[model samples]
Target chain A: DAGVTQSPTHLIKTRGQQVTLRCSPKSGHDTVSWYQQALGQGPQFIFQYYEEEERQRGNFPDRFSGHQFPNYSSELNVNALLLGDSALYLCASSRGRFYEQYFGPGTRLTVT
Target chain B: AQTVTQSQPEMSVQEAETVTLSCTYDTSESDYYLFWYKQPPSRQMILVIRQEAYKQQNATENRFSVNFQKAAKSFSLKISDSQLGDAAMYFCAYRRAEIQGAQKLVFGQGTRLTINP
Candidate 1:
């Protein structure tokens, strides 16, 4: 009955550094997607993972990548972080590619 | 490339009154899905309501309802008997209806709603 859960509620990283955020999808869900929400703006899609392979990706650069484990958990990694990378990263899970997606509380990444 | 727009940056309503947030999207595909998500101060994105493009009936959830105009490509959310708890940032999102692989959601800029008692 547990919903989507993300780790490290808040994080601080310096420029040119790397960071990884984790997410455990909701029970009975398989697909995981990541999104970035900048200040005063809505979330922008980062990418989606299904069957341990990346299925869809947004316009994000190569610096942003993700991984999905067999257990349906996911990790979002951002390399060479910049101040603009500071935002709330959200993790959403759904039963399949065409189902309703439920989101987690999100990890707040602060690039210093 | 689909884009969702929420022209209202902010809106306010008196407690127990009603308020509507506007949203419009541009998509080349005819079959798609639209959603309204509520993000509170806690930053959790909660699904408020959703509308399927093929369906003529607008989607409704409890006190929340949507007016979907397919031709106009407009989707607006109406919150009835608004309460303080309803004060939050509301986002409009769109997704394609492809049955094959996963699709990413395109979100609007978001409308911040403030409920005054």
Candidate 2:
């Protein structure tokens, strides 16, 4: 079974540009969550999507948002990107609100 | 806020020997879950083992195991019969078993492991 899949293994964008990252959860999972991993640091939670609605969000600003489709796939959008937005964007999926999660390889975003 | 700490930045072990990575977390919640994830150079997060606060027996998966101390708030991972594939950045994570979307993982910085022949 496919665990989890993400698009655009690597990306480069300029400041003020909008970028969207996609994620497909594991076959049996129903919840999708997004995180940001900076250099030499652990991942920080961005937000979570369930039932086609945003359920929870982290410390991120309005510039960051996400959506969950009917098929359990999700997308993360970052607008007005700042130079500090350059980092590894990670997507994790679980069966429910809390359970064993499976993560994707992650998309490395470089904001110039 | 819950925080996980991995003091050892790096460690090395003989190919066939055993190694343990230490981890300590600070949380006010009594009931929570602890997990160990291995991230290789590919940057994929792989689950190694997990432990529940209510469970007394530590969780073990094949050659990977965890030492969970609820009172001390310590969760350590012990790798037996270390292999070359085991060389990766191991992370300690904490999650609340809640029903809300607030249930998210808090990860430690990470410990890079190296295996020598």
Candidate 3:
């Protein structure tokens, strides 16, 4: 089974533009979470979506938002992106409320 | 706030040898989970191994094992018979085990492993 899938392996956008990254959850997983990783740094939590609703969020600002679809897929949307928005966006999926999460290949976003 | 730290920014291992990556975490809660994720050049986050707080026995998966010290709040990963393919940036992560909602994983800066043949 496909563990997890993310679209647009790589993207380039200018400042102030909006971008949407997609994630398909692993088979049998219902919860989806998003994270941002900068070079030489660890992945930082952005937010999480479950049952089509946002359940928890990290310290990120309002510019970062996400949605979970009925199919268990999710989308991470960054609006009015800043140059600092350039990072590898990671998507992870888990079953129920388990602590272990399976991650995707991640989408690399480059803000110019 | 919960935080994970990987003191070693880089590590090297000779092929067929073993290497261990260090990790330390700060958390107020007693019950939690720690994980080792391998991110190769491909940039995919692959779960290497995991340890549950309540379990005293260190978690092991074949050639991958973890050294977990609950009292010291430390978790280390040991890779046996290392191969060139094992080279990657290894990240130590933490998550609250009791949370039923969206649990966020706090990750360490990561240690880049280089396997020399």
Candidate 4:
């Protein structure tokens, strides 16, 4: 079975620009969660989507948003990106709320 | 709010030796799940080991095992016969046991493991 897959292994964006990262969840998975891992730090939960609706979110601001399609793929959109937004965006998928999540290779976003 | 902490920023051990990485978490919920994930330079987070808070027995996966002290809220990973491939950033994460909505994982600051041959 194919694990979680993310698009654009790397990205470069200017300040105040918007960037969208895509993720295809593992086969047979239904939920997708997005995380942001800064350089030299652990990943911080951004938000989670289930049934095409956001069910849970972390301490992130409104600039960070996500969408989950019926196919279980996800898109993380960051608006007005700042230099601090430069980090590795990771996408994780699981069967449901209670199962273990499998993470993707992550898209490294470099906000210049 | 649940928080995971990995006090060790970096650790090194000789090849074929055993090393233990420490992790502690703060949570008010009585039941949850703890996990150890290894992120290589490729940036894929691989599940190393996992332990359920309700399970008294520790979880083991081949060469990796966790010392889960539920009462103490401590989850430590012990890696035996470490190999060069084991050199990566290890993270400790926590998830609530709630089954209704999306349960997001809270991760620690990650420990960088170095395996010297």
Candidate 5:
């Protein structure tokens, strides 16, 4: 079966600009979660979406938002991006709230 | 809230040898999950192995296994007969059994593994 897939393997954005990253969850999965992995660091949870609504979020600010479609695809939108926003964006999918998540090849965002 | 820690920033092992990466987490929640993920140069996060907190037996997945110490809050990954393909950043992660928004994963700083041939 096709696993989690993400769009734009890499990206380049300037400060204050906005960017949107897309993800198609693994087949048969229903929930999507976003994470940010900075250089030399493990990923930090950004937020998670289920039933097309956000259910929980991490320490990220309002600038970081996400959406989950009925088909289980997801979009992570970061507004007013800063250089610190430069990191690898990862998308993970799970069948439900208490299942192991499958991850996609991250999109490397380079904020210039 | 939970926190994961990987004290080893980097490690090197010769091919065909065995390497153990250490991890320790702090959590009061008795029911949870522990995981080890491998991120190769391609940047794809691959689930290496998983262990349920309630399970007393240590988890083993082929060449990859975990030493899960529930009371000590320590979970370590062991890779046997390491190959060049095993060179990657290994991450130790923790997830609460409580289902909330897909269950957030708290990851450690990560341990970079280098396999020398």
Candidate 6:
């Protein structure tokens, strides 16, 4: 089965520039979550999307937002990006009632 | 709020040997879940193993196993017969059992494991 897929694999944007990362949930999975992983650090939860609505969000500022599509694909949009926003964005997919999430390779965003 | 902590910043093991990574979490909720995820250089978060809060017995996955101590909120991962492919950044994570927003993994800073041949 196809696992969670994200794009583009890498990105470079300047400060104040807006960027949107896309994710396709794993086959047969319905829930998608986003995370940010800094170099040499574990990923931190950014937010989660279910049923096409954002269900839970982390401590990220309003600049971070996400959407889940009916087909279970998701997108993470970050506005007014800062240099600190540079990190690896990970997308994970999971099915209902079970919390074992499958993750994508992640999109590496570099803010200049 | 739930928080996971990994005290070890790095660890090393000889090929074919065993090593353990430590982790602790803080959560008031009785029912929850804990997990260990491995991210190799490829940067993909791979689930190594998981343990349900209510389960006393540790969970094992072939070469990977967890030692869960509920009273102390300690969940450690042990990797046996380590190979070069085992080298990666290991993260300990926790999640609320009743939470409904997918597997919102609260993660530790991570332990970088280096397997030496």
Preferred candidate (lDDT higher): 5 or 6: 5
lDDT string for model 2 (B92-111, tens) is 99998766545789999999
Q: Count the backbone clashes (under 3 Å) in each candidate.
A: 0, 0, 0, 0, 0, 0
Over the stretch B1-117, how does candidate 5's per-residue lDDT look in tens digits?
789999999999999999999999999998999999999999999999999999999999999988999989999999999999999999999999874445899999999999999
Per-residue lDDT tens digits of candidate 2, residues A12-67?
99999999999999999999999999987889999988888888889999999989
Off by over 4 Å in 4: none
Candidate 4 CAPRI category: high
Candidate 6 Cα misplacement greater than 4 A, ranges: B99-103
lDDT measured at residue B57 in model 1 versus the true structure, 0 to 100: 99
Interface RMSD of 1: 0.9
Residue A63 lDDT, candidate 4, scale 0-100 = 96
Clashing pairs in 5: none
How close is chain B to the truth by TM-score, in each candidate? 0.98, 0.97, 0.97, 0.98, 0.97, 0.96
Q: lDDT score, residue B39, model 5?
A: 95
Give the fraction of native contacts in model 5. 0.91
Screening candidate 3 with a backbone cut-off below 3 angstroms (N, C-alpha, C), the clashing residue pairs are: none
Q: What's the C-alpha lDDT at position A89 in model 1?
A: 98
lDDT of 3 at B117: 94
Return the number of clashes found in candidate 1: 0
Instruction: Put down candidate 6 lDDT per residue, B1-117, tens digits, no spaces.
Output: 888999999999999999999999999999998999999989889989989999989999999999999999999999999999999999999988985445588999999999999
Model 6 residue A85 CA deviation (Å) reads: 0.4
Candidate that would win on lDDT: 1
What TM-score would candidate 5 get against the native?
0.97
Worst 10 residues of 1 chain B by lDDT: B97-106
lDDT of 2 at B113: 97
- Give residue A93's error in model 5 in angstroms: 0.6
Poorest stretch of ten by lDDT in candidate 3 chain B: B95-104
How well does each candidate superpose onto the true structure, as a TM-score? 0.98, 0.97, 0.98, 0.98, 0.97, 0.97
